[model samples]
Target: MTVSSDRSPVTDAGAPLDGFAVEGSEGSAAADIAIRQLRMLGAASPGPDVAVRGAGRARARAEAGSAGSLVLAADHARVACALDWAGPLALPLEDEPGVQAACGLMHVHGRSSGGPRPLAIDYASAVGGVLSAQGLLAALIGRLRGGAAELVRTSVAQAALISVGQYLAAATASGDERDAPAAPGGPPFTSADGVPFEIETFEAERWERFWSLLGADRAALARGWQPFQHRYAAAVCPLPPELHATAAARVFREAAGAAQAAGISIVRVHGAAGERRRSDAAEPPPWRLTGGSSDTPGPPPAPCRPGAGLPLDGLVVVESTRRVQGPLAGHLLRLLGAEVLRIEPPGGDPLRWVPPTVGTCSARFLALNRGKHVVEADLKTPEGRRQVRELTAGADVFLHNWAPGKAAVFGLDSADLFAVRPGLVYAHASGWGDARQAGAAMGGAEPLGTDFLVQAHSGLGGLVRPRGEEPAPSLMTLTDVLGGLLSAQGVLAGLLARCRGAGGIRVDSALYDGAALLTAAAPSGGARRPRWGPLHPPLRTGDGYLALGPHARSSPDRVARALGADRPAADAAAAVARLCRGDRAADVAERLRGAGLSATPVCTDLADLAADPRIAGALDTGGAAFVRSPWEFTS
Candidate 1:
């Protein structure tokens, strides 16, 4: 089904931002688009529509009138300076190699046997855009509550870092090592008919049952399960070769039949043509905000002010979510000063013991769950649902990531919750929004909407790899990270609507929409595969590799000269590789940076990133290591 233009049901209700101006170079378009999308959702307070202008500092300053405007910038120093003049808000959108490397995203994305290569898509830049929008909403919320202006800052590098926070935590944790080498291996396992597809199952019994039906050896099935399960955290799956051979022995139809019989989910990779067909349809908005059952704003909020606290300070959030997307959303809200109370099943979440622990809990799980409270309850039971409703009664927000209809089955849906807590911001961080209807057009039996599966279905798997490489998901949990950010963005929008005299709001954010955003923002294939060569390509050095940022790619001649090569822009990549073959990656990167280019060593080791001084402030390495919040708020 094609996406509809009816995004936010409350768009016509209010427009708080009378003057919103974005200032920066052409590179700031990603961030600009994010702000505009939020405005489209009616996230602003009651006023005229958001006012957008050109790149000049003077132009932005002049346009931002006394109504308290928000100014976003691409330069960090420029934003810091703007805070003094632009009273309402000042946000920095920076995407540079130094931050990306420090954040360890470069390491995670490029992890493979063939040496580290840059992610084909502009992850840092795209995610930075989403973050910038969130920052604006948060700053606006602060202003509305405290009646004072604030400074909010984030960079592409920080966004990239948060995306890989789980992986970095696992790498630095104690006990058994959970990750395998970055060797080239993992899913989209090919069938005898040459069709590449991915399979997913959260239950080991189902995994065993599916492989057994496909005639895979008992030993292979048992051996492959760990790596397959580890794939999400490790960012690579080194499955036993026997399993690959097993899948290769059967046609796609036969393997699919086996999956159906076993009650597991399977989906073939969406090729370029199929992706083009899907892309032809209108992409869904980042989020959909609908009013709740109540027409009133519910209980009057307690008197609170931003003062010296975060934007969401004094708010309570009840979160019932498993896995990365939901937990990350709650985590982001907590960073914005909300008190998030996590609802886990009885005996706590099983993943808390997945290994590589800090103290008694898994560091990987803690990466996205630090600084949150937990409650034990089983939604399968009536009493458990009652307990959740009781918690939601006093909370400002209720967030969850249950299956499509699971919440309603337990009577914990938006309507049900709104009955108990009128103005609650109910957010469903789903895997796929209306997947059944949408999947019908995509031609499939409706696969489970997991991170890798969404990546494959959205054509991101094909786009993220180098041009000639095989198409497969990055295993970096790309969709989950961005989806989490989108979920938080939706929740903030809901809160903004409620603050503006609108009733309780219901927000729907999905991995599908997040993937659509990433794919839509990506450059066309031709532009990505430029005449000068691959955009932001990684160059191999004597000992390791160095990744060139977009800035460096733009000045190929400078790069060639720094590497002691003389060649036209088209051959600069080859020339640099040849000349830098005997130089250390760090040395080569330093030389390029000295030439006023953007380049950095591809941080293959998480430990190296922890040691990198440039982004030391972004990491909390005491005990359980994890990335800190990307945003730095100041009043």
Candidate 2:
């Protein structure tokens, strides 16, 4: 079913794309793009390729091999295809010849200023896609080191680590997040009137109070009821379906009173929260911001300006996307200097409608669609299909995030796009992929949670399984887009394989997959804390929260004295605030370094941090603040 394009892969075909593109849009060309404009603006593309298609061996070899390679999209519909190696004649794959491809897409979704309407946690998965990219890269690197067929390694650490880094980079870069508001906690929905409700969504309990203020029985007053406590007990009973609502409300009010009265909490439930509002109200981590209100780019950095010049450039990419999952693929690719073009339908990508388009479109949309060219097209239309066929011609990589069984509707199913673009690294992402989680429908229109659905359902919640689900839903999500990032790594590995003399490759990461990756630490390890990766967590200091390291612990030895030690010199202000803040009934800890002991500190304002030159510098465009890919090239 491979559709052959009559173009010169080596020499151009007679208008090879002549019959493939949609009418009226035939004059497009990559050379026509303002690549110079982009590169001048600091957006370089992936550079040269050493692999070239050999003398007619690709098709010939494919015809000879029957023990075809199996491309598994998930645990279900596992595919077995005659995957022929065309690298010697095409692009060098990034990994070995065989692989037991990982199942599912890492759905890392986020609600950028401009993104599709609140797709909820679906966006978390969308954002998580960045991790997929990191993991795949790290994994491919690992594979390149050791040769083994049917084997692939992923960076269990890089997925979450890079994600955290991206967020931190975004926040610290502009020092805006320091002043950003906390995420809004929305209204608490009640089931009709009678059924009681529990505060589960968006840290609701932080605002309101829990209660059980059931009143005492009156009839019993005349007969046997005397004590108000007894009546309250019966009224507050959880077993009675008839009394749940009344019991819940009374408990709510009483708890609310006690909490507020004790200066413990308040209500934050109200409306739809957006990026600006959330960032404005967001409780920034207690770190000094080095940069001020500077949103300016640094002297218009060159494309792929990975400091020393080493970077991935001249890379070609086709993002076959819709909603969050697909666009995120382009997002990660763009970060690394790939020339990523987003193919959309006539009205543009469906996600353009996302309430707050963040990037150049919707706020939410913009947040995820950064770094890409948008082309209006309808794959369903012959012209649209033809255009994609034209645009993707000779592209280096391809990615599509579509729901199960729906890929063909737009001719982007696993086989469609890849067949025509063999050495083109390919990636696919979806919920309940073509594997075991396939067939089952998603809850309502959205798939799942905002930031922690995988935590609520899959990670901690234990929900999605081999196919049985509840009619009643509990959450929304963004973890799936993680597939885009992780998938990037997978695709890169494939490309790398060709470089190392292997065949083509396929990569997948689902919300569930990302969720699975998150559960790395041994559940608390009874007494020991887990590794925090790279640097240790931060701690409360004389002024604010600072990342304590051997620097913090041995500082006393290096600078002065210890806290509880009598007659100690150099008793720095570092541990002053922490000494007095005891954990209610327990003693505080001073351990650091090997233990990675870091405190998250009590909730506080970030005004001080935003004003700190060091913190600002750390997040400034001059340092770790700017969005620069970890790459460089020798001029």
Candidate 3:
């Protein structure tokens, strides 16, 4: 394979690298993104001697890498083929309008009775490819350092997990309640004069301050809407007539302004009629490597035989992370055959008490943190600090998601740790990229790196909004999941450098960078706004909902036949809708499959997901039925 030595920044006008062709088909957009990232990191040449293959075959190659050169693979359908056990589902390569409709992101809509319409952009596949590429890069780095070649895998289904992880976490907690708690009706509201704006006051103090600023009656607050759960439930359920009237009175820009003055978060909702310019300038590169030199050389480590264990066997990681992102990275590392010891505060991670508890563990905590060792430490104390330093002395990787500078306060920053472990791979996951960016975004105040705030700040809420309606944040914490995966990728890349006898390396990933990548990857122009279109959106069958692709065939009659209806071409949609309305969604789906047309039931709840035979084997029944990591080692 021919490898290019041109190490230059990739731009929109950059030429494609040679010898990096995806095997067995035309290169997919997801592959293109992954290849670009890998090339940028100098892990692989534009023409690396690699062949991308199917997940099943790729798994075998990765397993064999335990005794040989590292094998890196990216399967576009890894999740569907491996995790869901759905065979050979081909996804669109480009970010088309209806791509998300296939996944159910399009089902999220304004409070209207209209048919399901496509969301503006496709995010899952692109993110999946990018993350998969990062994973492969990490493996490649490991291989170069005398480590055995490893297999790196990523799939669209795995990427789609981010869009629903929060919901899945909630589902694991509540058993039957698959939905997360609503955080009040904070969407954009129209003023009496017709100007539109949005406001948020999820915190109790912020809500009280907002009420005080609005001069609302204390009696209104006394009606027992103080707790967030009550407010969240109120937001999801229809408001009573009196409550509606009261809420309707405050739908004005002035109310939003007052709320903002009281330290609440608020913004004017932008329209799709005009091009939306990005508020911040283009962000810096998503990944950075530090403390590695090309001139250094060291004896390669011994290669191990395949099938001994996961690819990361014999690796040691020290993690000081909590909540979703950092813990998630550590979780993946643990699954990949690394020994991860999670260090929690003396009082334990705050997530331990986040409700929907099974005995003492929260569902969120359990879902993100499985198969890892844990310990308690008080970083404020010298002994705790000494303990951490000792742990780092023997660790290959040190991972953390603390607020920017919190590590420095505890003397656990890269500089401090490198003194003890010069060859350590330091990975830092954050809500924002670095202190400068965080300061600029928060006006010099300490920023809370929560997923929701990052979503709003990154303009994702506006991008997903229906036309002429208030922007809504996704119920899923897309950034947190993606950030976690990317952070893991960074750690792997650092490890690769260390294998090359490079000194201590620091890798940085953040929610802001993930969001920016999603935004940047979105197709420019030609986006179909959400609306009821023929062959688009889910159709209501009598017993349930079904999403069918209109572009899958040349004739609408074929669609009618797929739905088991014999009707004229002109009336095909109506006939199919009528026929499906009378039949069970499963039966209709089976019949459509028999006819070779693409179709799927609109899964409305976690129970529906759990009922699937493919998913049944992966559910954890120890407490609530939580989903196991959607990956397996063939070896």
Best model per lDDT = 1
lDDT of 3 by residue, 1-635 (tens): 00123422222112112222232112445554565455555534313344344435555543341211123333212211111211122432123332343333443331122334444445665665655565554444444433443444344544554345444555556444334543233333455555454445546667666655666565554432343223221223222233323335665655656665677655444443123334333323456655654333222222434444445777789999976789888987876678898888898887776666656777667777767788888888999999999998888889999888889999999889878876677888987676575556544443466665566656665565544545555534567777887788777766655554556677778886666655655544212233334445566776667666445323557768776555465677666667778878668767866776666666545544544564454455565666554444332
Alpha-carbon deviation at 577 in model 1, angstroms: 1.2
Clashes of each: 6, 157, 8
Q: Select the stronger candidate by TM-score from 1 and 2.
A: 1
Models ranked on lDDT: 1, 3, 2
Each model's lDDT:
0.71, 0.32, 0.55
Q: After superposition, how far is residue 594 of candidate 1 from its true place, in Å?
A: 3.0
Candidate 1 global CA lDDT score: 0.71
Lowest lDDT 10-mer window, candidate 2?
Answer: 96-105
Candidate 1 regions exceeding 4 Å error are 1-3, 9-25, 43-102, 112-114, 174-183, 273-283, 292-294, 442-445, 525-537, 551-558, 566-572
lDDT of 1 by residue, 204-272 (tens): 999999999989999989988987888888887778888999999999999988988998888777654
RMSD of each: 5.2, 20.6, 7.0
Select the stronger candidate by lDDT from 1 and 3: 1
* Number of colliding residue pairs in model 2: 157
Off by over 4 Å in 2: 1-311, 322-325, 347-367, 438-452, 460-482, 501-503, 521-561, 564-626, 630-635
Error of 1 at 565 (Å): 4.0
Evaluate residue 274 in candidate 3 and report its C-alpha lDDT on the 0 to 100 scale: 23
